[model samples]
Target: MQDRNVYTIQQLSAFSGLTVRTLRHYDDLGLLPARERNSSGHRLYSRSDLLRLQQIMFYRELDVPLSEIAEIVDDPDFSLTEALERHRKRIGAEISRLQKLIATIDTTLHTVNQETMSDRTNEELLYDGFSKEQIEEINAEVDLTYDPAIVAESRKRAKVMTKKEIEAFKIESSDILNGLIAAFRRGAAADSEETLKWIGRHVDTINRFYTPTPEIISGLGDLYVQDPRFTEYYDKHVDGLAAYVRKGMKAYAESMRT
Candidate 1:
C-alpha cells in the first residue's frame, strides 16, 4: 500500500542524490525525520520532506553541521534570504583563497620547469606571494615563543616539499581549522568527542611539520592563546576558536599522559 505522493528512502535517495544511509542518519539525528512510516516500517517522505531535504543539502554543502542545520531550518526567525546572502560571502572568500593557492602552485610549477630552478633561492621557490620580509615576520612570530633553531628546522623541512605537497599541507591545515570551527559552532565541550576529533587532526598536522610529544603539544596549545598572531588566526574563524583550540589541545595532551 505505497502512497503515490509519498517516497520511500530509496526513492528519495535516487531523487535527491543522497545515499539512503545518509538520509537515515539525518532521521536518526532528528535533522530530517521521515514524513511517515509504512506498514513494513519503511521510512517515507512527502513533498514537504523533499523541500526540507533540499534545504538540508544546501546547508551541508556549506559545511554546516547537521545539528546547526536543524536549528536554522526549524527556527521561525530563520530567514532563507539571509542565509543565502551569508553563504554568498563565505563561499566567495573561500574561492578567493583557493584562487590564490592555485596561482602559487602555478608559479612553483613554472619555477620547477625553468632551467634557473637550481639558481632560485629557497624563498623564491617556496613562499610564493610572501616577500622575504613577510616570511621573516611569520618566523619572528613563531620564534617569540619557541626556539629560533627549532622554528628554522621546521621551515627547512617545509622548504624541501614540492608544489603539490605544499598545497596538500595547506589543505590539511585548513581542514583542521574548519573542523574546530564546526565543533565550536556545535557547542562541543573542551574534551568532548567532537572536539577531540579536531584535536586529533591538529596533532596529525603538527606531526607533519615536526614530531609532537605530549609536552610539545601542550606548549603549542599555550602558544595558541598567548601569541597574538596565533590567537588572531584561530579567533578570526570564530569569536573564541583560539581558546577552544587551546583547551582541546591541552586536554588531548593530558589524555596522552594518562
Candidate 2:
C-alpha cells in the first residue's frame, strides 16, 4: 500500500514547483526538514511539510529575507493571518506607486507627441533637453567665436534641418572627434588618409550648419587649438585632442587648395 500523507522529494518538487536541490538545501538549513526516509534512504515529506512549503513560498512572494522568514516561521507565536495582512498592505502601497508611475509616463508621452505635432523648429526640438543655462552658454559660445552675421546665419540654417538630420549631424560630429583622438593615440600622422577621412567628416559637419570655405576651415582649425573653451572641449576627450584635430583640419584645408 502507498504511504499516506507522504511525498517523495521529486513528488514534492512537482507539486510545489520547487527543485529537489532547493528542497534538500531547505532541509539542510532546518527550514523544511523531511518527516522520514524511505527504504531507499530518499527524503519523504508529510502533509505538514507541504503546508510549510506553501508558507515559505508566500513569504518569498512578499520579499521576506530567507533568514528572517525562517526565524518568523519557526517562532511559536507566529500568526499566518497577521503576516498575510501585513503583506497585503505592503502590496497595496507598491501597486499605488506603480500606478502613479504609469500615469506619469502616459502624461510625458502625450506632452512629447503634442509638442512634436505642433511643428516646433529643429533648433527648439534639438535643444529641448538642455537647461536654460546650457542653452545660454551655447548661444554665447557661437556669438563669441563666430561673427555676429555668421552666428545669425547659422541659427537660420539650423532651423531648416529635420530632427533626423540634426541627430545624424550630432552623431557624425562625435564620431569624427572620437576618430581623431583614436588616430592620435595610434601615432598616425595628421595628414594620413584615415586621419583626413575624419577631418573630412568634421568639415562636412560644419558645412551642414554653415557653408565653410577652405579659408574658414583653416581659420577654425587655429581657433580649435587657441580658444580655451574649444581646447577644453576636445582635450577633455584626449590629452592633446584639440591640437591633433587642428593639425588634421589644416592638412585637409591645404589639400582643398590643390
Candidate 3:
C-alpha cells in the first residue's frame, strides 16, 4: 500500500506547481533530494520534502538566488519558524510599496483624465507622487552633482513633456529598474553580457530626459551608491541593488569609452 505521507515526483510537482524538469534540477543541485524510491526506482518525496519546497519557493519569490537559498535552508541552526517571521516582514514591506505605487498610478490617472487643462505646471504634474521635501532633496542633489547649465537644460526638457508622457516615462523607467533588479537577484556577474544589456536599456531610458555620455553614465552609477536617497530607493527593491547597478553601469561606460 502506498504511504499517504509520501508522494512521487509527479505527485509532488502537481502539488507544488513546479515543473518536473525544475524538480529534477533541484534534485541535481541537492536542494530537495527525494527520500525514497519505489521498486522501479522512481523518486518519492516525504512530507518533510514538501515543507522544504515551500521554503525554497518562498525564498525564490523574494528573488533570492537558489544557491543562497540552499545554504540558508541547509544551515544546522535554521529555524522554519524564524524564517516564516522574516518572510512575513518582507512581504509586509512589499505590500506597503505596492500600495504606494498604486496611489501614484491613481494620481496619474486622475491627472490624465481631466477634461480641462490643469493649472499645475509640468514639473508639478510630473512629480505627483513625491513630497515637497523629497523633491527639494532631489533637486539639491542634482545641483550639487551637475553644472547649472546642464541642470537647466534637463529641467527645460522635462518641462516640455506632457503629463501622459511623464507617466509613460515613469512606467518605462520602473520596468527597466525591475529588469535590473531581477538580473542582480539571479547572481549574474556585474559585468556580464546580460547585465550590460540591462544597463544599455537604462542608459536609453535616461537619454529621454538628458543626453548621457559614457562619463555621465559612469557618474550616475557612482551617485546611485553614494547618495543616500538613491541607495535607499534601489535597495528597497533589492538589497545591494544600488551597488550591483553601479558595477554594471561602470562596466558599460568603460565598454563605451573603449
Candidate 4:
C-alpha cells in the first residue's frame, strides 16, 4: 500500500506542472531527490519534496541558475520564511512597475482618442515612464559624459523621428534586449557568438541615435554598470542584466578592435 503522506512522481508532476522528465533530472542532480521508492522501484515524493519544488520554481522564475538554486536550497541554514519574504518584495516591485506601464498606456490612449489632447509632444511621450526630473538628470549626465555636439545630434535625431519610426525603434530595442536576456539565462559566456550577435544588434540600435566607435561602445558598457539609473533599468528586467550587458559589450568592443 502506498504511503498516504507521499506522492508518486506522476502525481507530483501533475500537481507542479513540471514534466516527469524534469523531475527525473532534478532527482539525478540531487536538487529534489525523491524520499524513497515503492516496491516496484517507482519514486515517491514526500510533502517536503513539494515544498522544495516550489522554492526551486520561484528561483527559476527569477532567472537563478539551477546549480545555484541547488546550492542555495541545500544550504544547512536555508530559511524558507526569509526566501518567501524576499520573493514577496520582488513581486511587489514588479507589480508597481506594471502599474506604471499601465498608466503610461492609458495616457497614450487618451491622447490618441482626441478626447483629451495632451500638450506634451510625441518625443516627450516616448519617455512616459520617467518623470521630468529623472529625464533632466539623465540628460545632464549624458551631457557631462559625451561631447556636447554628439549629445545634441542624438537629441536632434530622436526629435525628428516620426511616431511610427519611434515605435519601431522601441520594438527593435526591446527585441535585442530580450535576445540578450535569453542568452544570459542560457549560461552563454559574454564573448560567446550568441551573446555577441545580440550585442552587434545593440550597436546598430545605437547608430540610429549617433555613430559609436569601439571606444564609445566600451565606454557605454562601463556607464551601464557605473550609473545607478542605467543599472536599475536593466537589472529590473533580469537580475544581473546590466553586468551581463557590460561584459558582453566589452567583449564585442574588443572583437571590433582586433
Query: In lDDT terms, which candidate is top?
Result: 4
lDDT of each: 0.81, 0.81, 0.85, 0.88
lDDT per residue, candidate 4, 148-189, as tens digits? 888888989999999999999999999999998899989999
Give the per-residue lDDT of model 2 (tens digit) for 181-248.
88998999989999999999888878777878788888899988776668778865654778888898
Model 3 earns a TM-score of: 0.51
| Deviation from truth (RMSD, Å), model 2 | 17.5
Per-prediction backbone clash count: 0, 0, 0, 0
Clashing pairs in 1: none
Best-performing candidate as measured by TM-score: 4
lDDT, candidate 3, equals 0.85
Residue lDDT tens for model 1, 83-102: 77887897887687667768
Measured against the true structure, the TM-scores of the candidates, in listed sequence, are 0.51, 0.46, 0.51, 0.54
Candidate 2 segments exceeding 4 Å error: 1-144
User: Model 1, residue 187: displacement in angstroms?
Assistant: 23
